[model samples]
Target: DQQVKQNSPSLSVQEGRISILNCDYTNSMFDYFLWYKKYPAEGPTFLISISSIKDKNEDGRFTVFLNKSAKHLSLHIVPSQPGDSAVYFCAAPFLTGNQFYFGTGTSLTVIP
Candidate 1:
């Protein structure tokens, strides 16, 4: 099964706090990992990504950690903001240019 699981359907945090989003995958062949942020009807924007060769990737307030052995990954948002209040999706691609499989998505709310 091409199941990438996001256990939590929602999360809430205060501004300037840390927001953690978790994801897991069942397929061992997935080599590239990506995190996207979605707001309502718009498409998800690429937030950060890591390859099978790397264990972690960071970009400004966002960071993604991969544990190949556990088939798991997580996204951490430092100093979470109201702008960060949106749905996040974790996707894995089988190969370059291939369609990606998505998790159910995590809706995050950041209070002022």
Candidate 2:
């Protein structure tokens, strides 16, 4: 079974709106969570992250929220723009620290 999962395969939002992406993990040992954005043929760029100890972390237009008790986390983008269209992935390193687990990813499209 997959350790991390993105329940939504894709999401579309109008420009200047909010885009919400959700992810779930089965591991309680995941101490840190990160969100990454990827464009076609390009590598994923780190967006934002929240530690298990933190309930929320925000960076400019992006924010990541973690609910450790529920083993869930979410990414929120404000004023979504066409340029923001990309695949977003949630990831965390395993307890061993040598390996990491990533969600399948959720494709986000911001319509102009």
Q: List where candidate 1 sits over 4 angstroms from the true fold.
A: none
Compose the digit string of candidate 1's lDDT tens values, residues 1-112. 6479999999999999999999999999899889999999898898999998999999999999999999999999998999999999999987564678999999999999
Per-model RMSD to reference:
1.2, 0.8
Per-candidate TM equals 0.94, 0.97
lDDT of 1 at 23: 97
- List model 2 lDDT by residue over 44-95, tens digit each: 9998988887899999999898888899999999989999999999999886
**What's the lDDT of the predicted structure labeled candidate 2?**
0.93
* Model 2 CA deviation exceeding 4 Å by range: none
lDDT for 40 (candidate 2): 100
What's the number of clashes in each of the models?
Answer: 0, 0
User: After aligning candidate 1 to the native by TM-score, how far in Å is the CA of 77 from where it should be?
Assistant: 0.3
